[model samples]
Target: MSVVLDISRLEPRQVLFAPSPLSELAEMLHVLSAPDHHPGLRAWATATATGLSSGLADRLAEADFLWHATRADILLPARPAATLAEELDALDERDDETFVASALEISCMAQYHRGVPQPLISAKDAQEARERAAIRGPRQAAFADRLLTDPRGVRAWLRRLFQDCEREFFADAWHDARTRLYADARHKTELLRRKGLAPALTAISPALQLDDQQQRLVIDKLVDGAGTTSDLGLTCIPTAFGRPHLVTMITPGWRPVIQYPITTPDLPRPMTVNLLQARLEALAHPVRMRMCRALARGSHTTGELAAAHGLTAPEASRHIARLKKAGLITTQRRGRYVGYQLDLNTVARLGSDFLDSLLR
Candidate 1:
């Protein structure tokens, strides 16, 4: 579904724009996990994949569940940390109970809708821990048992994974990206100061909408949830690695975060052609054309699009993916159904954009 932030109680001063190394690291790991989904990171992913140690590779696989729960507050600093090392130190300093609880939340979130079990933070005994762990699955159940028995060991293992990932690739990557990321943050901060929250959020992503009447910042996400801006405030981090989609951390315990794509001024002329081709190709298919026309009228779920076009589910999905990859459509998830809407603005600009690309 969507995450609705009750912004009525929030002040303009409560919304902050900052760059976070930890948030960037999370996105980097995600890109590494599935590079195919992130074309921009393909080269880096390929280069980095070659040198990963066997131990780190195994640890990454084992801890893959934690990345799914990136929304967990433990993985992120309350405010922007100066460096990845600084964030790592903060994470390492967390108490055993808090560390285990955060890990559990991350692992549970691997399967959508499987949120953290109740009273887990206060679970004092083994039976309670096992019961809470049972709700997650065999992997998490075992993890919970390990956490209860040896939290320090679990924390050490996770820390080592983070350290190894940094030492291997992200340390250098962050060094290169940090300046651009901070510049973007400063630009967003100034924009926020001048234009206020709604415009700033809109500038961040089309997936974000300020529902003024409802006093909510509505974020279009696959997962359905709600959170409020904490006394700690809301932080928006501009990321180089996190692109195409906005990542929100609205889980209850955390200071709400919106990790948005960095806006760059330069697009090489060659990239313009590539982007134009992708969009043109996405629109070229007859079924996709029909689907876009239908979507222009109103939003339609994949099943609805398939049924209307008399296509199989896989075929419909393939078409939808093409349009989505081209940035021609936006998705809004409501319960189990995700509805897609065509971006008429991008569609309208296609003609001029193509000409501009060719001429320039």
Candidate 2:
């Protein structure tokens, strides 16, 4: 489905690229809940100690398994509060009825085939969704039954669940990642001021395209909602983690919210390799080759790689460092653990350049 965002009349100031820790928390929970869907995150969760247990993990597990029904819009309200403290305060003060209704709406909406949030805003549309209910999980079906009626109870349970997760699973990581996101936002803001909207936005994600003629910023598979920035401006936030990104178009109306992944480095890097044999030698070891294949599939920790290879953590790390120095693999901080992914481009260039030189 396509998300048509009407940015036709938006001023430079109308579009703000900010950071939201609360938003990132929801995405992080989703990643934890659905490991198969988020392969890279799965590796991180497997390698790290999340400290989530009992209620919080179980609830997130339930919600994640029922993601289609537990729509991110319902869990995230996508509040555009300036700070995490402000956002937390707002969420804490949110009344029972509104909170309950949103939860129920999301629970009911999860039964449908659509992934967008716009259709669930109306009573008629929600009723239509209920009529066409298509759910796969028994736990979710049972929970939805209770959620449809006793929303207040379910809402309370959710508040407790989130508090547990925030304290146990997310608090520390949230602080560091939030700081990075804030810096990312500030950098984008400076770029927007210097280079204007289109250039700055494209820099955020090459997938973002501003069509002035249609007054739309098109992002392929970003969301399933068509939104307009007629009144309130658009807020684009740099997320440390959302892969493929997420968009919030809670109409009637809030400022359109875009949460895209900060996947690439902000600045260009000089080619750092001193010798090509270093790369070839790094791959010569069978242990390193296994790690490379594992990293190529997704991301891996030195610990996980060690366990797989029957090596100690220090031994595995030594090998990993050699590969990193060779520019064959690179590390990324994922939650509490560091993950490694292969530098396929460098690997290809090494092979191609070597063959070209020999032929010459």
Candidate 3:
């Protein structure tokens, strides 16, 4: 006997809450589109003005890279000849506000560096140096003392300090730089007006395509309000595995939003109290919770998860299958192994709602 499945007959509520491998796909998209800045820096800055981390500095560097690359095609003049590494080295050589400013630029560049070793110093060391320097002020003597004790710490501390300075003294300067860049792009377009670039600027098309199934998945996410316009703005391109992916920022509203090729969008909409409760209920199972935590770390095959959890391979598969059905996890086959990863963006939203409810 043959069993026939009718997907179209499924109700919206059923599909929305059902577990499916597609859930993970949605989660990956969310991470890609979220802001590029390190959320940790924002959290730390709000909590303490003095604590510092080299990791945070590195993140700032990567963000700078993104800002630059996103606008690369425009043929704007090069940012002053100084490279991030060169600027850092110069800062290490000097002991003045000029050095601090240079360090800040390096930090911004570090924010965007893909594979470089992050924040040259440990957080504890950076924090201590920040404290000492804050109390002693920006005198060369104090700066020297901090540097001698913890060069990495001193640099990280200075980077954070300079970020505040930039916000104060150079905010307008950065704004003007951006405006000039745009104006230059427009000027170029006007000069080349008869050429196709003007019409190309009108309505941006999807840089990629989605298969019918992927398109339907995206439509469902958008309709359920699980993902916002910003999240779904980019067209999904085909990956090496033939799965759809997106990695470029697409304009949605006034902001340019980055979309991750293999991730889901974390919805910003508030979850209803009932929905929050239901999500928590879904997560309450010990087996499910373990599965969620594991997926958060990265993808794993059923056998690998079973081995890690000390369950029989079939039992582990059953549990994962359940989670997939619940829309809590997703699996992809790679040769002999089917890898599983969490639907992080959805989990994050649900987790945020749970936390908010508790606070309320």
Give the TM-score ranking, best first: 1, 2, 3
**Runs of candidate 3 exceeding 4 Å displacement:** 1-278, 353-360
lDDT of 1 by residue, 1-360 (tens): 677887777777887788888878777877777786688789998888778887787777666556543445565556778887788788888777667666665544333243444423444344655765578577667767777778888888777878888898888999999999888778777888998877776777666778858488887766677888857578888889877557776666567878888766663211233567789898888888888878877889999999999999999999999999998899999999999998876776676554333233
lDDT of 3 by residue, 1-360 (tens): 111112222222221101111112222212222322224224423333233255543443332321222221101111111222333343355444323322222212222223211123344334433454345344533444444456567567655544543444223333333343334334434533444322322211232222244222222111111222322221212111111222222111211222222211442433434445556676777886776777777889988888888999998888887677666777778888779988777776565764343234
**N/CA/C clash count, model 3:** 34
Model 2, span 227-306: residue lDDT tens? 77887877787767566445454443556677777765642322222344577788889888777777767789988999
Total clashes in model 2, counting residue pairs 3 or more apart in sequence or in different chains: 1
Candidate 1 accuracy as lDDT: 0.74
Model 1 spans with C-alpha error above 4 angstroms: 68-72, 109-141, 265-360
Please state the error at residue 24 of candidate 1 in Å.
1.4
Whole-model alpha-carbon lDDT for candidate 2: 0.64
Q: After superposition, how far is residue 226 of candidate 2 from its true place, in Å?
A: 2.0
Q: Please state the error at residue 115 of candidate 2 in Å.
A: 16
Lowest summed-lDDT stretch of 10 residues in model 3?
Answer: 72-81
Please report, in order, the local distance difference test score of every candidate based on alpha carbons.
0.74, 0.64, 0.38
State each candidate's clash count: 0, 1, 34
